[model samples]
Target: MNIVKVDVFQARLPLIEPFIISYVRLDDMPTIFTRIELDNGIVGWGEAVPDQNVTGETWHSTYDVIVHELAPLLIGKSPFQIDAIHQQWDAQILGSPSAKAALDIALYDAMGKCANLPLYELLGGRAHDTLMVPRVISIKTPQEMAEDAKRYVAEGYKHIKIKVGTDAKADIARICQVRDAIGEDAYLRVDANQGWSRTEALQVIEATQHCAVEWYEQPVKAHDYRTMRHIRESVSSAIMIDEGVQSMHDLTEVIREEAADMLNIKLMKAGGIYRALGLASLAESANMPCQVGSMVESAIATMAGAHLSMSRTIIETNEMVGPLMFTQDVAGVPFDGEQLLLTKAPGLGIEVDETYVSSITVQRACIE
Candidate 1:
């Protein structure tokens, strides 16, 4: 059960289209994929989508931390001792959550494989066999956004998350246009990505009140809890904090201040499933709903997210559409339209194709 070898593969996958949030635009998704081989010959996989704007990490930094820092700490360690490993990581590593997340996922995957169980079962067992994931429409013109919405809806997606936080007036128009194109039955949500000022957030929310937005996410900056509370109180739509809630402590603070109505938990931000479970538990205790989300990642990370999403009934939405956004997947798993079917196979329940991975891999390393 002790980790004997670790392999890190860096790959760049071209997106089906350019994904634009308020802070950044990406035409290709750069991911750090880690494979940990244990003493008994069992292998586990993990993926990291490093975003400098969100996790304060890039591919190079993530790779360096995994190879030079985290790998030595992980080698010869039992995968079952996840809590101790996490504690050591928190003690030694300060802010490289994305880097730590890759290792965390790999360890969990190894544990699941060792026990011959799926990750969701290891987390807490499955609450649902399938998850209805929401497709995200990146920032674009009103017409283009509407078209994207329509296309996704036509493809059997029932939920769509629109990116906003640019011009208040244009943002309103974008929501309204997409709402019109998708009709009233499909659920519509908007993520501002902490792109707008409090005043602008309030103005846009008020203007788009008629568009029936299910929720408004991270309207202001991540640290401005006061303004987040103000905007939440000012609007009827539920307010979800994504960038704001990075840890259990952050979630506790947001709940204590009554800053947001919902929480968006991502493995990259929370570090891994270990911390993500804590955040979800804290949010549930506070009666705040949760949404499981991820960066633009391949199937490795997206499958990890799907395990977490299915493990808890408190997660009301799934935003693990990263695999769907790409033209190809580095791994293979069953996907029924927007819903990803959970596998009974061990670990994350997906198999990584090393051949395809190597084809797209830009960098690689092995630590033994």
Candidate 2:
């Protein structure tokens, strides 16, 4: 069916608490939601979470590209021609993967709905029916973070990811305190968000060696391949590259250098499911593991990630806890305490509450 119209909405949702990372702290998330309507009355949904620090995009830029550039290109295009549309986008667009991702996810959702199957079935099949989500403890005082960790564990979370990389000593204290509070049985991971030097990364890893961290992610800068490889060689903790591994080219470089033990694949970074699938394939070929992640997004994007997480067996871990971080959900889905239950409903298998979305929306645009 040909796409007849496209609608874009920008929603600003307040977080339950300030989300602290190495470089910045966020009290709310600005997200762009997309709806693509087909001539046959079928509609698909998508969302884009623009993080200037992470995806190099802001809400305005993402909205501009989707409305002025991508929407015109997509008008009258068949939803079934997924690869062809993506190929056109790649050739015509230079950057702005998050903008492309918004449309890409919508196209996939539409296709899945047309086939009367969930998005995962179209990707492959359900390798997992439910995904174990990891709760992220944003950067805080060692004691505060420890208390947060304990609370998440008490809420039935099995996995906890700590934000670090500001100070080696503080990071050490944070990890140790959290580990002690959680009683050592829970799985723990750390993401530095490119906050440390190679030496500092090593120091932190060395100090926290006894804490049993499952992985250390993006300790050094994203482009610093030499330092990343050096840190990987020096540390015993598995290194997961997040900002460093953006596209297939970046993944190839990381694989060539053996710099990372795992990859944090976000739909925003990989430009959506199509390219993410390629990245997953390449990572699997090299026997590298992957963690499906999000950019502090809403349930629209989180459900998209949830579908991708279950689509393949290569995704060993999931950090799609964006929905849990917000004070209110703009959409509804089946999320148990630890696992996100995938539904048999068509498309992304979730429904957006348009009224709630409209209440929080700051901008809107429509192309027909």
Candidate 3:
């Protein structure tokens, strides 16, 4: 089907609680979403969550690029010619991976709906019916963090990821605190967001070697492959590459160099399921494990990631907790339980809660 119209909407959902990391503290949540309609009246939805911390994109720029530039480019292209359209967009739009990602997913959604198939099936097919998605426990006081870990454990979550990269002593205390509170039943993971130095990463990993961490994600900066390799050798924890590997080419170099044990693929960071799936295949062929990540996106983004996670063959863990972190969710999908369940609805199968979404809109676009 040929593209008939593209629409953009900006929404700001309040966080249930403020999320603090070493680099930034997020209070108000923002999401830029797109809806693409074809000539025959099929519609599909997608979301863009620009990470200034990771990809250096902001809300306003993302929305503008989609509504003014990217949408116009897609107006007459065939929705099924996904790669050709994406490459054409990339040739024109500079450094707007997040904006491009929104359109990429929208095309996938549109095609999937038109064909009456799930996006995963359209991409390749399901590796498994479900994946173990990690639930994040935000940074807080030692006791408070431990209490938060306990709550997730009580909810039947077996894997818990803790946010660190602040003070060395406080971070050590936080890991110990959560371990003590949970009593070693839950699997623990850590995300430093590249806030630690090589020496600091070494020290932190050494200190927590006894805590049985499942993996350590983005310990040093993404650029410091040498330090990442050193830290991986210094500790027994599985080193997961998050911000470290941005594109398929980046992932290729890391794999060739043997930089780390695993990789974290966020659909937005990797661009979309199209590119994300390609990278996942590369990792799988290399026999390296990968996980689907989230960037404070609503259920729309998480569900998109979930489809990839389920359909991909080599994914082990998931950090898709965007809905759990937000005070209100503008989209609906099942993530409150231990396992993230697939929606029975057609295509991606979740409906965007437009009423709640409209209440938080900072901008809106119409399909002309």
Candidate 4:
């Protein structure tokens, strides 16, 4: 079907509470939500949550590029030609994955609706129907963080992701405290968010070995493959690359170096669903397990990751707890504790609440 209209809405959604990582603190998430309508009267939804540290984009930049630069390219184009449109975007634009991701997701939604198929069906049938999601405990005091971990575990969560890397000794204390609180059974994944030096990464990972961490993610800087390899070799826990591997090229480099045991594939970082599948393929060939994560996104991007996570068995973990942390969710889907049930509904399966969208939107633009 021919595409006709591109509507971009810029919204800042508040977190239920402040979210602090190694690099920055966020009280609210700035996002670009997209709606693409075809001449056949089908409408598709997409979203872009630009993390300045990860995607190298701001919400304002993502919105501008999508509405001004990318929307023109979508006008009159077939929504089903996903791959060709990506190639076109690459030829015309340089590096704005966040901007392109919004459009890419929107295009895929339209394609799925047009074909009357669920997203995972289009990606090849799903490997698993239910995903065990991990709740995140942001950087906080060791006691506070441990209590948070206990709260999640009490709520029947089997997986917990503890954010660290702001301080090495404090991080060690945080992990140890959480491990003690959650006991040895619940899965704990530590994400440093590239917050330490090579030496510090080694020290923190080593000191927390007794905690039985499922994985240590992005301990050092994104470019430090040598150190990552060293830590991977040194640690008893698995070492994962989140900020380290953004593209297939980055994945290739990490593979060449044998740096990481796992990869975190975010739709925003990998560009979108199509390219994320490409990343999953490369990771599969390399025998690297992947975790489908989010940049604290809404239900739109979160479900996109969930659908993709189901498409591949290699994706061992789901850390896409973005909508869970939001003060309000426009998706109108019920999320029980830690267990994410996938729907077979066409497209992303969750309809966006434009009424709720109108409340949070700070800016809006429409392209025809």
Candidate 5:
């Protein structure tokens, strides 16, 4: 099938509430949603991580890159040759994984539609259709955090991931409050977002030993692999690396140095499904556990992650709750229940309602 045009929509959706963390806080999501329409009248959709602070991608930059840089590279290329397109695009952009990810996902969706197969099926099929995605409560006051955990449990979520990287004492108290509130039956995990000092991480992890944390992710900064290894050695709690293991280079270092017991894989950081799969393969070879994470995404990107998570062998946890957390989503099918489910339609197995889309789109570009 011949590729026709690439459409970039800059959209802003309100978060259910302002999501706070040590690094950044977001009340409104400013993102670029990409839709690739083929000449055969098939359309595939994807989302770019427009977190300017995290990836240096903003709505304007995403639109410019896709329309002026990426779209031209793929307009006439065979949609099924995913790798070839990536190789060409990689040569052009030195480090725009977030932008590249948007195009890559759209192209994959187009390929799946051309083949009349579900996206997961083309991605080596799926091992499990349903996965337990834990509910994440942003770090807050101990009392408020405990109430958040209780609310998640009341909503039927069996697991919770609390954001930390604030004061060690408050972080520990937050975890304790959550555990006590949710009771012993729910799984508990923490993401420090590389906000702690080595000493701080150590003290916090040691203090929370009573909380029975399933794992503590990126306790210290991303570059401090030495500290990561040290923390892994010093603590009884499992250590997972998030920002630390964003690329194959990072994955190599983490595995070679034995820096972590687990890793967090996010589509935005890993570039796309293919690169994500590569990271998973490396983790598999090293026998390391992985958790599929999100960078506040819509159902399109989250479902893309779910497809990858299912086909992989190492993912032990899931955090694809962006749709649930965001007040609005651009995707047609939002995640349902505690599991992130994909629709039965071909390709991404979802539809985009133009009405919802037009309501949220901050900008739009058409390449005719």
Candidate 6:
């Protein structure tokens, strides 16, 4: 089917509270929701969450590019030429992966709808029917963080990911207390968000080595390969690079330097599932485990990531708990305890409340 119309909306969704990470405190999330209608009346939905800290994109930029550039260009193109369309969009713009992701997701959504298949099946097929994810506890006081971990554990969450990286001593306490709260049966992972120095990363990893961290994610700055490699070698805990490996080149550089033991793939960073699939495949080829991470998105983009996560068995764990972080969402993810159940619905498999979405829209644009 050929694209006939495009509708793009930018909305500001409030977080439950201020979400504190190592480098930024997010009180709300700005997301761009895109809808594409085919010639025969089929419609597909997509979302773009432009993270200034992670993807170098803002909400306005992503929405503008999609409305002024991507939408008009996509008017008559066939959604079936997914790879070629990505290359064309890449040549059309530079470093707007989050913007490009909006369209890529829409195209994939439309393609799935056209094929009468669920997105996981359209991407390939299910590696598994469900995922038990690591619920992230954002940066908080040691005791508060420990209490938060306990709550998630009480809710049937088996894997807990603690956000540390502010101070070595405090971070150490966070990990240790979380481990004590969860009782060691469930896995504990640490995400520093590039909040630590090489030395501090080494300190935390070494201090909490007894806690059995599944892996340490992005401990140092994104490009600090020397420090990353040094810390990886200095500690027993596995190192998983997040911001450091945004592209294939970044992945190769990390692999070449022997920097990390695992990978974290985000759709917004890689442009969308089309490129993320390639990155996951490359990591699998190199024998590295990968996890699908989130960018503070709603259920729309998170489900897109979920489809990609279920497409392969190599994606061991998921952090697409974005829907859980928001105070309100137009759509909700189906969660059964720790497992995110796969929807059999075609495309993204979730029907969003258009009325609720429009009520939250700060900006809206329609192009045909």
For candidate 3, what is the TM-score? 0.96
TM-score, candidate number 1:
0.98
Better of 3 and 6 by lDDT: 6
What local distance difference test score does each model get? 0.89, 0.90, 0.82, 0.89, 0.82, 0.88
Model 4, stretches more than 4 Å misplaced? none
Once model 3 is optimally superposed onto the true structure by TM-score, how far is the C-alpha of residue 5 displaced, in angstroms?
A: 1.1
Across 23-104, the per-residue lDDT of candidate 6 in tens digits comes to 8887888899999999989888888988787788888888999998778888898889888888888788888888888888
RMSD over all Cα atoms, model 5: 1.5
- Cα displacement (angstroms), candidate 3, residue 84, comes to 0.4
Clashes of each: 0, 0, 2, 0, 0, 0
- Stretches of candidate 6 above 4 Å error? none
Instruction: Encode model 5's per-residue lDDT on 1-368: one tens digit a residue.
Output: 77778888878877888888878888777777888888888888888876565566766777788878887887876778788888898888876777888877887888878888888788777767578888888878989999999998999988899998988889988989999999999999988998899999999999889898999989987878999999999988899998876689989998888999988988888788878888988898989988789887887888788777776658867788888877667665545668777655677777777789888887888876
TM per candidate comes to 0.98, 0.98, 0.96, 0.98, 0.96, 0.98
Residue range 1-368, candidate 1, lDDT tens digits = 79999999888998999999999888888889999999999999998888888888988999998888887788899999889998888888887888888989999889899999999999889887568888899999999999999999999989999999888889989999999999999999999999999889989999888888999999999979999999888888899999988877788889989999999999999898889999999988999999888898788888888899989989878888888788888887578888788878999988888899899999899999
Whole-structure CA lDDT of model 5:
0.82
Superposition TM-score, candidate 5 onto the true structure: 0.96
RMSD of 4: 1.0
lDDT of 3 by residue, 1-368 (tens): 88888888887778888888878888877788888888999887889998887887888888888888788888878778888887888788766778888888888888878888877777667778666776787778888999999888887888888999988788888888888777777889988888788888888888988888888889888867878888887777899888877788889888877888999998778877788878888998899999899887888788888887878678877777887787678776686576788754556767777677778888899655
- Cα lDDT, model 4, residue 140: 96
- lDDT: worst 10-residue window of model 3: 343-352
In candidate 3, position 17 carries an lDDT of: 86
Q: lDDT score of model 1?
A: 0.89
